[model samples]
Target: MEDINTPSTTGLMDRPAGPDYRLGAIPLAPERFSTWKERLAQWRALRDAPLYLEDGRARAARGAERHAKRRLSVHHATQYGHVFSNKRIPRDVQAAAMGRFEADLIALTPRRVLVLEVKNWSGQLKVAGDRWVQVQRSGAEVTHPNLLAHNREKLRALHRYLAHAGVNIPAERFHQAVIFVNPRLEIDPAIADHPAVLCMDDVGDVLGSGTSLGRHMAARLVQLLTDAETNATLAENLLKVIPPTEVAAATAAIKGLRTWDRLTLRGGRELQGDIIWLRLTGNQAPAAALKPGGAASLEWRRGVIGGIQWVLRNRGAGNLRGDIFWDQHLVPGRRVPLDADDCVYFHEPGEPKPSIIALSHVERLQIG
Candidate 1:
């Protein structure tokens, strides 16, 4: 817990000493995921096949090379698409190509491989244009396969070099891709038949395909990509649960703290202890109804563009109006008494409240 010194709010009774807040820190472990963790640990162990002569050194060099190439590829991609025509190769273009080049050179990858090539270009494609072309809907043209061809040749060259150094991988298993990064792009008919080229939308599907290389191999691949012992191990260990959705699923369990809670409101006050209801209105501001425990307090902050003027309850019956504030920044939890501009009220389900669309989704507090 910490203190917020908003002392200027009336130097009396230490105003901001209301709530104790702390970030949630949950310790996640592979043991929590049941059988998945063990299964992956076994897979990762297989990646250290000890097939290469200088296994450690080879992995490091390959990772560094790949990282450099990726950097260049991204840089160059930024400069593409314009009428530059690859003239002197703009600085960004050079960077993007370099990244691609490095990606081609890195051979310390695990089993599940994704060969990605990115391109940015605009111009109507055709059924045939020099080396590559393709037909499109509405009878338009696309770009040539020349760009793809160049990338393929480069990849093959790098592959050959690595193979001679003792690494052996089949062509089909390697995977090849030509990415069209440009939002506005056209593919020529020739490129259509080119097994390497793929549209952007399908890229994720393609990358996610295959056996996932289990857990062991994925870790080694991460190692090869990062060129470090710790990162590789960390990436490997995380495979137990894989993260992202897992994190969401794990944390969402906490929301159940208030799942079965209930509350009701009438007029401008609350009848239920757990829930609070009140009506408030003012001259020039947005009106809001709040239940003390349920709807919480009016969260309108001072100096803010808009202010919540009042809390609303069963309207036509009471026409309730009370409390108003002109400011920005809500108090913690928007807590406020009934008198000040920031007051709270409550309402029973389906009760006549404000027509504000957002009011329907309000969270009610729990009180037994």
Candidate 2:
């Protein structure tokens, strides 16, 4: 295997054929000249046109903003790579309030959901309640919208939206922070120790340290957020209501679900199943799992069908067959035969304890 960390001088095709060579060469390098020429011409046209100067400036500003966002994303990924991050959540999907209310970044772990409001403004700033007073380089005092308040509202909206969608995430598990992209920006001491606020330099100390949420909780949170069906549902719903322009702006920032093994479970339990549903309790439970009059918990499941057989092992004295249900129904339940193509639902009502079945009437086991 090639050492990815080490730089290679030779191109894939130029390297000598050997057991180490794994990639095949593509013959399209020569064809890319025309595409490059076209891009160069367009760049020259934009540079030469006086009428397009403003457009160029606007494009440059947008490019800088995107670069800053990308840098911040990379930094956070380094600090909390196990966490799931969604950037530029649309106003409608977040708060559904009037005017613009986009969240710059939203990160989720099993322990908490971090809402980060990113600002590139360069100056000294002071936080007062729900407002930020900025002193510009020109010594001019200016007031900008308070990111702390905005992020809090975004978190509130997210919790509400999740609840309405049947994906319960608690308000307490949601955290808010402001990330000043400008390194030179000085923050007032009054807000320096605020738990919700984070400077560009404080990310490593806050997220990477064990003093806050531990790595185990962070990993679990990431797993819940990256669950295939749940992520798809949330994305689909958000895209349905958000504006096209907002979608376009956020497209690059939205990350895909992280991959894991088919039967991977929390606490590193490797069980056999196409779908493994984990009923989490206490602090391990997801925000959605917090139910009234009960300890907060979350049921997380993920996997694809096939290659794994479903069965019911009878612990009773005699052999027997019984009906299987896709979901636990109040009635007798859906009757699914052992040989059917439908999914089998396994219920462990008393979790942390194994379910007892009669020896004669237990699930049959088969590999294929």
Candidate 3:
């Protein structure tokens, strides 16, 4: 692992120094176009007499997200991992999915993948059967869907996406929580005692070395993933599922384009060069498939004298499988691999020979 002494990483943790406590936050891209003119709005709209710039609940939600992230960054947690903020499902993946799910934040560690949904609502909150009701200061009441159930669906969708990309981790290894970020919020005792519902101050207890009502919640978290994978392996696999543009944006945020690539090795060595590609091997196939005209005709069946029933049948088909050689590259060239060596080849600007490092030793590769 690379040293955590660098300025870029030191400020991320608020607790006293601990060995191997490395953490990083990936930066998201800013908005591209600001004004309607820049976006080339319709002539009729642009010609309107007055322009409207309003902020409602959206502004409050954004503020709460900022507050939650800030508190999380400084929390005295012993776990080391990367936190992805405002993670959006890629457009291509969303097209085939039923709903547009967005995670407020995703905390990924070797042992646990935690999905956090932050809510900034401030009021007297109560659980009414399957829904939640909020009593505002102005004597107004608002009803909201069950956030706990909604976040659970998001977690399941995330698992589906990862499994589709060949990174199959046990569902037990994933966890979800709904964090109320507003300090002014008041929650009913019945619902606040829930395991998945938490307030801002409870974050450290659930995530790391802290306790909730005499319970070692952090230790309990470890029990959820008895047989966990290595940090590097999970990171590499997760990178495959994440879009390349987002990866590039994260690289730019961590360290500017000072080099073509930054290779962080598990042995604490950092190298600068052009990372051509990564050599990964796996097999992929659809779970099942159907052949053309595989449906059987419907038939009517009669029970002794009770009723008539229609039966529909289908002919099962075989699965189509293929080997996957995913070698993602920084600079484009031949996409296919010529050999089976699982190593990363790095080349300096004017170096005659490329440095070959075994894939297992590399911790992370950041593209410039």
Candidate 4:
């Protein structure tokens, strides 16, 4: 297990404090999907096969490459789980040929958008101008792809993709990092000194350092990535059946509906909707005639523009009659007109007091 200790920084944005406020998790091991395992097996089988077997060698190389990527992906999940796990933006996205470049991981923080390239090579590595060389354990030397050059192309393609999707992230805000996942690997002093190149251990310290503004920027970046990922997932689920214009309009409408004051209760429960019901735990009566049962219901209905009809109902035994005071105020028999942001409370007469159980709101209405 890799431990990442983030240094406390000043200027972080004010946010909710608690365990639930965290964005991601760190897993001890890389996730091994069936596809990755299959590729690994294929690579191992053909790696030392006949030299004349060109197709086998090529397949083996691809397998090795994918296996390395998988290992790095796992390492990253463990090392940066707190910052990246369960984030809105999907990591390790494989682009189609049309995208021109595939990314190992795309991380969006408040300050910048990071495109990471994971290289899991062992032994000694050196870079001379545009050339990258790797020396194996058996004293064998080989030239590998120029990761920086390759990532540059990927960055350009990503920009184009974002532009086409109507995202307006500036190029200056886009950054890149090449992570060498192998712990046993050694790098030439010149290449290791480069800012963009990092070993697995250095990732946490670098990202965790800096001022409060940097931390806030990271948080915002995470949000943007998450939103982008959500939109992409929605688009995929819709199968592109809906036109982009209509989809954008519908999305905007949904966002508008969510802009209401949320009701937070004891035990960390929250309710935000047009209709909320509170079930009391004990017997409470507003009046002698009205024997209150253990439940109170609140309803909000839209009337004229921003006007709200706030209705409160008390469930009790026998024929109910007369009005009762709700929160030291006269309760209307029908509905009380109030502002959208008005707060309401329910009181019960016994131990283990009243609590909000359910909330229901109209998100959308479909018309044929």
Query: TM-score for every candidate vs. truth?
Result: 0.27, 0.38, 0.43, 0.34
Model 2 has an lDDT value of 0.38
- Which candidate do you rate higher for TM-score, 2 or 4? 2
Q: CA RMSD for every model? A: 27.5, 24.4, 27.7, 26.6
Worst 10 residues of 1 by lDDT: 81-90
lDDT of each: 0.33, 0.38, 0.49, 0.40
Q: Which candidate is the best by lDDT?
A: 3
lDDT of 4 by residue, 1-368 (tens): 23344434454653322222111322122122224344333233222222222244334434544654454444432232212211112111344433224455554432344556767677899986788899977789999777877776666655555555555545765567787766778998777887888865665433432224433344444445556655444433432222233234333322221112233332323332222232122222232222222123333232222121112221111111122223323444533222111222222223244332211221111110
> lDDT: which is higher, 2 or 3?
3
lDDT preference between candidates 1 and 4, better one: 4
Better of 2 and 4 by lDDT: 4
Deviation from native of the Cα of residue 40 in model 1, angstroms: 67
Q: How does residue 58 of candidate 4 score in lDDT?
A: 36
> How much does candidate 1 score in TM-score?
0.27
Please give the TM-score that candidate 4 achieves against the real structure: 0.34
| Cα misplacement distance, residue 110 of candidate 3 (Å) | 3.0
Question: Which 10-residue span in candidate 4 carries the lowest summed lDDT?
Answer: 359-368
- lDDT per residue, candidate 3, 122-181, as tens digits? 779998999999998777999988888888877776666665555555576678899997
Q: Flag regions of model 3 displaced more than 4 Å.
A: 1-51, 74-79, 89-97, 209-368
